[model samples]
Target: MSKTWFITGASKGFGREWAEAALERGDNVAGTARNLDDVQELVDSHPDTFLPLQLDVTDRSADIDAVRKAHEKFGVLDVVVNNAGFGHFGMVEELTEDEVRAQLETNFFGALWVTQAALPIMREQGSGHIIQVSSIGGISAFPTVGAYHASKWALEGLSQSLSQEVAGFGIHVTLIEPGGYSTDWSGPSAKRSDEIDAYSAVREEAAKRPSANDPGKPEATRSAILKVVDAENPPLRIFFGKAPLGIAERDYESRLQTWREWQPVSEEAHGS
Candidate 1:
């Protein structure tokens, strides 16, 4: 059966690819970008299948309207992919209060608003998928990506709690933790800290490394993600790409090792 996908940030990257894949599979897509004109070609080619909407995921009214329009067009929404977000690369202390808040506003709260808008419709239907395109940073931390990590980590926590809340209604939540895919996420949108003396030394070194926009083996990662997203019963958390899997594995292992190494001390401190 072909599912209906209402995806945010479909102008580029994973969201655009996913929308294309969905349409290729005979699914209907209501794709949104900050300016839907950017997706004019997609919409024009698939007039019936692709519905492009001008949307800012951060805008509450726009979210509501998008959901309404999607439901009106398809009658039911099978999936809502919250893929609209950017990255902020800087040490925690280096980021200004507004920058940190902006990170959360777009990556975390933007997703929340979209999901909140879609939940009622899905609940009424009694089935739907809510896929959040988080990042490996969600599960693990890195040197200059602390604010980015915080945003994703917030999504992970929100999704975990939301999964529990909506499980009874047959609504599913999937968090896609992708590491390095050749997306513009790492372009100028990827924030960098100013020359704050506290982080300049480390920032300067990290700045030389490639970002998500850098050339990479993205096809394999895209293929893996398509398989997961199109699967009948996809996993709650997906770690896509080689870098993501490696980071996830190392993070899990490090956590386990820490727990084991501190078991006795923790037990004594907690009296457990």
Candidate 2:
């Protein structure tokens, strides 16, 4: 039984890789990109197995329509990959209100809208997989990518709760926490905040870090995703790079240390 997939941001980056991986494996795919022409080559090459949809994931109505159309075309959606999101680079103080809203709207709320649209269909089918492309920052924060981290953190929380809620329906959720890869994420797709003199040191350091031009490959992440989709019981959280694991462990360890130190004071607020 060939699976059907709905992948957001299919025009490029990890989304494009995921779509190719699925099609190569003989699965049907409906991919959403803001510009249909961005994926015309894919549509032309895989006419029988690929459907390219024009979508802006932040638009709730468009998301619902896209999911419904995919379901109608494929009969069922075995996997729905929410991979449409851009990175916002800035310190908390440097970002404008609009920038903050845009980050949350696309990265957090956009995934929320698409997932909400897919839930009922998957529930009725009694089985499905929802893959959220969260970042390593979802578990730990860095200096300049604060806004991006905030968005992914919210997504992680949403997917965490969603997994528990949908487990009975056999709709498993996997959060793809990968470190920086060679993707447009830190390049053209990434938005930058205006200069603020006080944060210059931190911003300069961030700029020195590798971007999408790094040696790492997005294809590797795509391969990891395929492995998760094929597994009978996929982990709720799967990591792509050792960097993400290192960040998570360090963050958790530090938090635990603080928690232990505060135990007596923290327990005072709870009922005996």
Candidate 3:
């Protein structure tokens, strides 16, 4: 069966790759970018199967309208990928109010609005897959990108709850927690806060981390995404690259150890 996909940030990175892969496999795709020109080639290459939409996902109205337009064109939205977000780089103290809000507006709220817009349609159809393009940072935090971490972490919690809420309706929610990818996420597309002198050493330390330079190829993820969306029972959360498993294993072990160490205190606090 040919599926229909509505993908945000379809201009580049994983969005573009996934959109192209889907269209190539004869699925219908309504792909959105802030500028239609960015996705013009998709339309040119797959005229019958591609609909390019101009969208800024941060705007709630825009998100709703884009979803409506996609459903109107495709008749069904089998997969909805919220892939429009940029990385913000800074220490917590170096982040400005505007930067923090902007990060949340696009990374967290944008996905939320799109999910809200798509839910009614999916509920009506009684089936759909919602893919939230989160990051390894969503699970494990680092020093310099605190604001970015906050946004993805918020998304992680939101999607976990959403998975439970929408399961009865035959809708599936999956968080795509990708490790570092060779995308422009940390290049031109990244937003950076003003650096503070105190955090310079912290930034240097972050740069030396083992995963800092080892990014998976963006093209390598297309097959994984296709498999995920097509699965009879998709995972609630899946990692797109090699690095996230190790990170999760190490982080969760530490977290579990801490909780166990503090279990008595936690139980004591609950007592009368």
Candidate 4:
């Protein structure tokens, strides 16, 4: 059966690729971007199946309207991809309150709002899938991109809780933790804060992680998301790419070690 998809950030990167993939497979897609022109070709080619929506997801009301329109057009949305977010690059001190708020507004709260907007439709329909595009930064943090890390980390937590909350409604939530994709996410989509000289040495090293130019083709992620939505029982979280496992392993192991080391002190507070 052909499913309908509502994807944010559909102008480029995984969002665009996913939209293209879905349409090629004879599915319908309503792709949202800041400018509809970016996705005009798809809309032009698949006039009946592709919907190009000009949207800024940071606005909760706009998100609500877009979701409502998509549901009205498609009748029922089988998948909702919250992929409208950009990378915020900077150390914790380098980022201002406003900058952090902006980053959260788009990356964290935007997804939350979209989820809120879609839940009613999904709940009413009795089945749906919500794909949250998180990053390896969500699971592990780096020096230069603290703001980005914080945003993704919050998203991860939010989606986890959402998954539990919506399970009774047959609504599935999947957190996609993709590593270094050659997507425009780090290029035209990324925002940078003013550099602080104190963090320059580590900042230079952190810059080597990944970006739109280095992440490489995102075909695998596009494929994975499709499989997730189509599955009868999708996993709560799916981490993409090879690097994620290594980073996750190290981070978890280090955390475990610290927990074990502090167990005695931690238990002392219990007053047993």
Candidate 5:
């Protein structure tokens, strides 16, 4: 069966790769970008199966309209990928009100709006998949990118709750928590806060992290995404690269240790 996909941020990175993979497999895709010209190639290449849409996911109404357009064109939306977000690099203190708001508006609220818009359609069909493109930052916190971490972490929690809520409706929600990938996410597409002298050392240390130097190839994720969307029962969350597993293991172990250490205090606090 040919599936129809509505992918945001389809102009580049994982979204573009996944869109291409689906279209190549004879599936229909309504791929969106802020500038339709950025994704026009998909339309040119897969004329019959591709629909390019210009969208700013942060706009709630725009997201709803885009979803409606996709359903109108394809008649069904088997997959919806919320990949329209960018990274904001800065320490928590270095982040400004505007920067933090912008990050959440797009990374968190944008995905929320899209999910809200797609739910009714999916519930009507009684079958659909929602893929939220999160990051390793969604699970673990690191310095210098606190704002970015906050946004992804919000998504992680939102999707976790969404999975349970939509299960009865036959809708699946998966958060794609990818490790660092060689995408423009950290380049031209990223927003950087003003450098602070006090945070210089922290920035230097962050730059030395393995993820900063070693990033997975975005193209390598194509097969994994295809498998995930095709699975009869997909994972609620899946990491796209090798690095995330180890990082998650270490982070989880530390978190468990801290929770165990504080278990006595937690139980005591609950008492009358």
Candidate 6:
């Protein structure tokens, strides 16, 4: 059966690629960019398969409407890909209140609102998949991109809980932890903190690191996409890129060890 997929931030990055991949497989898609015109060419070429929606997921009501419209257009929603997000490359202290809010609005709350809107429909249908395009930072925090990572980490936590909640309804969730991709996720995404001078060394080093937009590693992105898209039962957490594996692995192992070390104390507190 041909799946019907709806993706946000679909003009570029992993969202665009995922939509194209789905369309190539004869699936139906309703892809949204803040400006639908950005994807007009794609929609024009695949009129039968692609429906472009103009929306900003941060707008809770708009997101709900888009999901409803997508369902009406396709008659079913098999997958909802939460791919709309941006990064704020700066230290917590260097960022402004507005910048922090903007990052959370798009990266975290946007996903939350859309997922809430999509879930009931999926539950009613009795089958669906929610794909969250989170980053390696979703699980592991680094030097910069603190706010960005917080948003993703929150999404990861929300999705993790959601996975368990919806499993009984035949709804599965895939939290895609892509390290870096050859998408406009970096150069275009790299936002400067107003207080850059206050944290110059860390900020400069962070800028040097590749992002999803200006990924220094195209091969890594390609490899990750291929692997992730082909997995039979893809994990709840997936780490992409040459660097993420080693770094995330070490972090994961260390966390586990730390947890084990703390278990005795935790058990005593719980009266176990």
The candidate that achieves the highest lDDT relative to the unseen native structure: 3
lDDT of 4 by residue, 131-204 (tens): 99998889898887888898999999989999999999999999988888777676787888998899888977
Superposed by TM-score, candidate 3 places the C-alpha of residue 149 at a distance from the truth, in angstroms, of 0.9
**5 against 6, candidate with superior lDDT:** 5
Compared with the true structure, what per-residue lDDT tens digits does model 2 show for residues 183-262? 77878999999878998888778766543334468787667888899999999888886466766788999999999999
* Residue 67 lDDT in candidate 3: 98
Report every candidate's CA lDDT: 0.84, 0.90, 0.94, 0.89, 0.93, 0.82
What TM-score would candidate 3 get against the native? 0.98
Give the alpha carbon lDDT tens digit for every residue of 17-76 in model 3. Answer: 999999999999999999899998999999989999999999999899999999999899
Taking the tens digit of each residue's C-alpha lDDT, what string does model 5 give over 205-229? Answer: 8888898678899999989999999
Root-mean-square deviation of candidate 4: 1.6
lDDT for 255 in candidate 5 is 95
Window of ten residues with lowest summed lDDT in model 3: 206-215
- Runs off by more than 4 Å, candidate 6: 207-234, 257-272
Q: Where's the lowest-lDDT run of ten residues in candidate 1?
A: 210-219
Model 6 per-residue lDDT tens digits across residues 1-272: 67898899888877777777778778899999988888987888799889899999889999999999999998899889899988787788887898889999999999999899999999999988888888889988888789998899899999999999998997888887877766656578667577757678876676566453444443334445445544556577766555677768789999999999999998999983
TM-score of 1: 0.92
The global Cα lDDT (0 to 1) of model 4 is 0.89
Better of 5 and 6 by TM-score: 5
Where does candidate 1 clash, by residue pair? none
Which 10 successive residues of model 4 have the least lDDT summed?
208-217
**TM match of model 6 to true structure:** 0.88
lDDT, model 5: 0.93
Ranking by lDDT: 3, 5, 2, 4, 1, 6
